[model samples]
Target: MLDHEVNRFNGIEIEAAHAPEDPECFAGELAAALAAWEEAGRELVWLRVPIERAALIPVATAAGFRFHHSQEDYVMLVRRLRPDALVPHYATHYIGAGGVVLNSRGELLVVSERHRRSARPYYKLPGGALHPGEHLVDAVIREVREETGVHARFEALVCFRHWHGYRYGKSDIYFICRLTALSDEIIRDEREIEECLWMP
Candidate 1:
């Protein structure tokens, strides 16, 4: 039988490490595992298959597993044992911040991306996706420094925008934060930024 661990929802998780190498062996063990789990009153089953063992995909799918989500190294599949089983969704939203930086002279800091797809130079507030566990205030200030070498401090939240159909079918929430510039120098990042300057 395939070894599995119980999740918080009392679901069974068959990790990649415990999957059998041979597809035939995996199918048999998976069948047995399903029967056992059903008897144990399990409502849901999660299967994580590594890219290296992609051959087991068809076998698992044939046994009623459906694609849930995918990561760089593994594919997550799910099986609902009960009719009304609730499977937690993958990350549904992405959070980011844009900095509305203003200098003492009332000039606003803006940037044009180097790799923009649009014909016209896309000029906007300097900002980017927040790193995991990074606060919105810290992310805005950091983005300003990274895109255009300007030191800034958070003033207030100016505005925010939310839109669906963003990257990877996930919705995005972009916060516009007001920041006061402490430095006057304009040093743009060459990799992602093409032109950065203080706009009136």
Candidate 2:
């Protein structure tokens, strides 16, 4: 539990509890905390519960807590105790783009980074994060060229995913795009890309 005197809020952080436990135990504690906070004239009560603790969600909701937002491993819930308190809303913060380029011979364009921090090297699609003020279509086209040294035409947006618990500790907007290659020749960014390949 943390006390934010500056914000006039009491924050309760709940970790995952193993099963075969009682939800009533947590509910009782939450009830007591709510009563105390109400009596103290606090503006808000914040509860951070990890997604793994699926069991605690109902207990919190039953106490009038509303979903705020999720980051990394925790989902934040809040209960407003004051009418004048301000609450923040969600916004899109990051954009990541990649392309799935296939050749006439039914091969896919893939690349491996030189400085990957993982235990094993994993090949990825030929694309990356967008530059400042860059459009999504332009970003995908530029990334494919930079990583594979091949010119590609953006066809359509294949799919996109929202990544939480990412390495950078921020939400990521990952866009998977479909593109057609203009050339067979492969040139790679030596500083970022280690190898480029056309895999079946």
Candidate 3:
């Protein structure tokens, strides 16, 4: 058993245990630790385990803990945390940010910028350059509002594509996918945006 204290917001003591040999012994120890933390007014209990030991999930669930899907090295199972948890700043660089917005009828929203002057004039997702110290979600929301003249709420990061020596030097293009049901009352401000259409 490992004992530690975390004093980020509310000071709470922590005790963690791991089982490299016997799974049955570790399960009992983990359950005891969780109960002790709860008695001490702790709100969260974290457990890290290998993906191969997925059987621990059932034990954690039985102990009132939930498993969160992650794309990291180890699987993270946690007990109750705060409801209003602040999102951490994880992205280091923001080369470019954009997302696909789908309406209620599963139609994709595309935009035509007034600044683009080309022969074909093809359309693209509604997003632009990311400002310094700006999060991807905030940058995308500002870009959609500026280019499409409509308010949007960011959903999640879908996929990311990296492009080198394109137009703006070496950059990482993130295709953030968001689901939004557009209302019929769209008030278009035609200064930066040429047109906004919902395409099926």
Q: Per-residue alpha-carbon lDDT of model 2 for 45-116, expressed as tens digits?
A: 766677677678888899898988887877788878776666666654688899999887878999999988
- Residue pair clashes in candidate 2: none
- lDDT string for model 3 (52-94, tens) is 6666667667777665434455566666654443323334344
Clash pairs (backbone) in predicted model 1: none
The predictions' CA RMSDs to the true structure, in order, are 1.9, 11.4, 15.7
TM-score of each: 0.89, 0.55, 0.47
TM-score top scorer: 1
Report the poorest 10 consecutive residues by lDDT, candidate 2: 1-10
lDDT per residue as tens, model 1, 72-103: 99999999998799988888989999998999
lDDT of 1: 0.92
- Computed on alpha carbons, the lDDT of every model, listed in order, comes to 0.92, 0.78, 0.64
Name model 1 segments beyond 4 Å from true.
none
